[model samples]
Target: MDIRPALESDLPELLALESQSFHSDRISRRSFRRWLRHHDRVFLLAVDQGQALGYALVTLRRGTRLARLYSLAVAPQSRGRGVAGALLKAVEQGARDAGALYLRLEVASDNQPAINLYRKLGYQQFGCYEDYYEDHGSALRMEKCIRPYAPGGDSRTLPWLAQTTAFTCGPAALMMAMAGLPGGYRPSPEDEIQLWREATTVFMTSGHGGCHPLGLALAAHRRGFASEAWINIEGPLFLEGVRDENKKRVMRIAHRQFVEQCAAARIPVRHADIDQGQLTERFQAGANILILISTYRLDNMKAPHWVVLSGFDESCLYVHDPDLGDTHPRQAADAQRSALDCQHLPIARDSFNAMSRFGSSRLRAVVIVEAGPGTAPTPAPAT
Candidate 1:
């Protein structure tokens, strides 16, 4: 059998196989047609004796380091003969070639055969979707870490933890940075919420609360790590989200309080952008960064986000982004490295600068947490 890219002529056979292989949630001919002509995606066919045995459709979203295996189907005649395995492997290799740090897929919960195959292929279940299919079948979200990622020294390890709540990204990132430092503490979900309570602004664009850079710096300092803050916005932030004048006043009061605590701690607060050059300098100086950025690149939402810059190389900056939702948000892949996992992200130089901000003005803020050296430190904290 020959494995190759699918052509327009293979569409008819593909549609038939898709319909035959699955009882529901099959890709339509129109969608298959679209995938064939799309430049950033790959649609491969396993052919033998001029007949299609299986087909795989994979997607690499723009500005995301994660590729998704959207669809894979093998003809009934070829199922027991390992046609599906070959197609899955080819799509995985294609995703790696496309520079994807990981690949994710959603399969029905009851599809034991597919689930077993995915497990055998090194895909681990990370999430679930209820009633995802038309037949009311729940979906299991599985992910595989695609290898040949950006190489860096093992001395710097930024442990990753997903924010339990959306507004806790800043605190969660601070938690990851602390978890990376020498003698740093490992925080639990409860600890994350507690940290958020201390650092959050109490009000944001539309949510419970979002942590400020000053708040995060203070949070880090209280934990025995030396912290510095750099923010582009001079005045109180998150006030624009509060419509009630009295509520805005309260937010400003809280913001001022956080700043005062930071000042009392002698944390160096700079009113300037933390450009790539400065970021690199800090990395070289042995500092873990908690950057407050906008979530525009991962999603179109112009909101505040926090990520930990754990390591860097000549090609990309490795960070542990706290937010997991909408990490893969585009149809075309970014020319730069994005995220391997929700916690471990690799951002390219130019794309990162654009991603590291909020609103039309692109507000930037970062907290540099520097700690003393340790002997034989591991990249990820031990349980």
Candidate 2:
């Protein structure tokens, strides 16, 4: 059997194979035809003696390095003939050639044979959805890094810990950064609250205060990590929302205290902007970054939020968002499973730079965490 791109003439067999492979969530003939003509979508088929055996469909988005394996189906007669695997391999190559660094897919949870095949082919489960299929079955989300390997530890291994509260994104993000290093701190609710208590600098309009860069940097340093902070503006931050002079005064005092504490602890505080190129370089050099972004791009809210810089590809940057808003609000039991979709979440390089700035003044803040004393920089993974 030979694998190749699907042509318009292959539509009838493609629809036939798709119907025989799955009982629900079948792709429409129109979608198949449209994707075949689309430049960013890859549709391929495996054929033997001009008989279609299997097919795979991959979708790519502009300005991102991610590809989604939208569908993969093999004819019933082609079972155990490695047709499914060959179709999948063809899709991966097609996706990579189109500039995708990763490929993601969702498979039914109860499909053990398909799951086994995916695992054997290097796809790992990252997240899942409950009652996802038309038949109310769960769907397991899986992904593979299709990009060529580079030096340094893969940041995708870092745990995805969502913020327990709306106002604790800063502390929650710092917790994830610390947890990514060798002998890193284990994150828990207790630590999350304590870090918030220790780092909060500005009292917001209603909710608990937002954290300052110095506050979070000092908190990480106290936990024995080497931390540095970069801020685009000088003086008190997160103050534009405050209407009460008393509250603003309090926030200013808190910011001053954090600045003094950071200085006494010998943490570097660079009062300048750190661009995306610099962030990518630091991340590749084995440091985890805690960056502040405007929630407008992420959730349509004009507010500040925090996330960890998990990884970077040629055209995209991946983040572990502490906010679970990417999906619907989830129960605690489902948070872990839902977090898979948010882990190593990709953002276009240009979009990330724009999202990193917050508020009308367009503030940018970052906390860079290096390995602690006596802990060498994380090494590259064993192939």
Candidate 3:
């Protein structure tokens, strides 16, 4: 077995390997030729016994500090044999040598095996797009930062929250608690609400930039509450506000951003249009959940993050905001209105109702799980 730079002679074999490894809509021979012609492109092939086992094609954009893994494939017979891993490592080294700061790729959402492999290799999920692929399957965009090698610190160390119970409140509380300190601290009830707003503000303004949820979600998950976010809005926002040629491009960027956030925190995020019945059906399948209902605060007339959906009784829903604290689980006339206000989305109750009357637009609740019943819950930090 040998790993080496791909030659012109390898194109036919490479194309065959790609077709066998992927579905019908993958890269074509013409596309492969164009990539090979690019000055910054790096294409590597792994062969054993004179047959192509796997291949990787990477393109470096010097000015943008980005290197994209355009195509990667391993023969079906060669899978689970480390061929893919070897090709990936070669691509990483090549990208780094080319002075790229970030490496990016897109994989199908349902491709869990590939997703896990990328995660293990330090690739973080950034976002996803609905029907981004030719077959209309969702695609997950992932990235890996190429930094100068540093020594001494163990990369696998769990975050400080995992080491101690200093910040062990629920998602919202934990985030507000952390905002009290320059680096980390606990906040008062008033401060908690303010901090929660600030943290989420950071997320929205930054376009959800970090590798994980900006504030409370990350803090809580680190301390053992498995928390996730449900993004509810109108039909495929990515597909809206863009030209046909650029729709895929925009969606790819949007999805990559969200997926990276979830990947950073090891949380799952489900994207859905509330009008879709299937979305709500999937949301109800989770356990120990908390729903956040966003609404505009009357004082400012600006939509701010408000209220947590704790649970529901027939005809009425419950919410828990930091401001309300233990006296939460408030009632709302309509559950959909509660969801809309919390998210600050532009859809009106009447308009939303008109579209969702026959169906439900409620966003999926973020599921939270405690470590175990035997373990005592960590106390919140003193304000």
Candidate 4:
């Protein structure tokens, strides 16, 4: 048997094996077609004598050195013949070649045969879900480090939490940053909404507006953290998307309020963009960063999103992005997101710089939080 990258011509046998291998939660023909063509996806098929034996699909997360084994299926007749193992090994190499340091997957908790195979192949269970499949079966989350561990100046470990709402990335990011600090601030789902309430500027097309750097700094200040803002734009931000005059007026009013509170709190405001070198210097000095980045490269949307910069290395910057929604186009309706793919994501220095700015005006914004009397020391570089 030989393993090879799947082609569109192999779709029929692939779908046939998919149908025979599982009863539910099967990948649709549309998804299969789309995933086959996606630049970030690796779909491999194993065949012998022109007969399909099995297949595996891996997705490379953009702006991160992480990949996910989204799906795997083997023909019933081909079981115990080592086809699955070959396909798995091939995909692991494929993911590594694509620059992914880690590969993660979800297996049914009761599927002992598959679990044993994964264990034999060196995947360890890191987490689990109570009822993940359509049949109410539990799932065991597993991960394998494809690349050798490099020590020093690596990412700092932080709690990985997904925002419950679409517009709550800022709140979720702030919560993660606060959790890593000295204070014992345990952020809950309730705090997510509360922080959004405190920092939101206006209304978004789908929900409330995104948070401003000044607003976030003020929120951090009120919570006893020393915060500072670095923004390139001078006045009322995120107003470019708002069309209603009344809403724009309200946003300006909210922006003015945040600016006033930041001034009264003595939070330093730098009306200029912060370069990567300066960001690295401040971070090494024990500051936590909540940065705004454009989701265009991440999710094909030009909207601003917030994430916590946990640490950096010579080539990549690690961040805890709060959003866990599907990044693939036309796949959200069928995809189930996992937190395993969102934590301590590694983005190349060049890619991070490109995505860190937002909009046609190229607005840049970031909030730096310094450890105060109650906060903890800066997190040690991750291993």
Which of 2 and 3 is ahead in lDDT? 2
**Candidate 2 residues 1-383, lDDT tens each?**
99989999999999999899989888889877777787768889999999999999887744346688888999998899999898898899988898777888899999999999999999999678899989999999998988764323353367778888878888889988899887558999999999999999759766679888888898888888999999999999988888889999999899889988988999999989998888877887778899998877544567788889887656677888887653233323211234544567677678888888988888999999988898987743331
Error of 4 at 100 (Å): 3.1
Best by lDDT: 4
Each prediction's TM-score versus the true structure: 0.69, 0.67, 0.40, 0.87
- Compared with the true structure, all predictions reach lDDT values of 0.76, 0.82, 0.48, 0.83
Rank the candidate models, highest TM-score first: 4, 1, 2, 3
Residues 97-211, candidate 3: write the lDDT tens digits: 8765567788899999999999999998856767777788988878776654221111111111110111122334344323322223344455434433433322222132111
Alpha carbon RMSD to native, model 2 = 6.8
Name the lDDT value of residue 303 in candidate 2: 79
Candidate 3: where is the Cα deviation over 4 Å?
A: 149-383
Which scores higher on TM-score, 2 or 3?
A: 2
Q: Count the backbone clashes (under 3 Å) in each candidate.
A: 4, 1, 17, 3
Of 1 and 4, the candidate ahead on lDDT is: 4
Compared with the true structure, the alpha-carbon lDDT of candidate 3 equals 0.48
Query: Residue 235 of candidate 4: its Cα lDDT?
Result: 89
Q: For candidate 2, give the lDDT.
A: 0.82
lDDT of 4 by residue, 6-31 (tens): 99999999899999999999988998
Indicate the worst ten consecutive residues by lDDT in candidate 1: 331-340
The lDDT, on a scale of 0 to 1, for candidate 4 is 0.83
Worst lDDT window (10 residues) for model 3?
157-166
State candidate 4's TM-score. Answer: 0.87
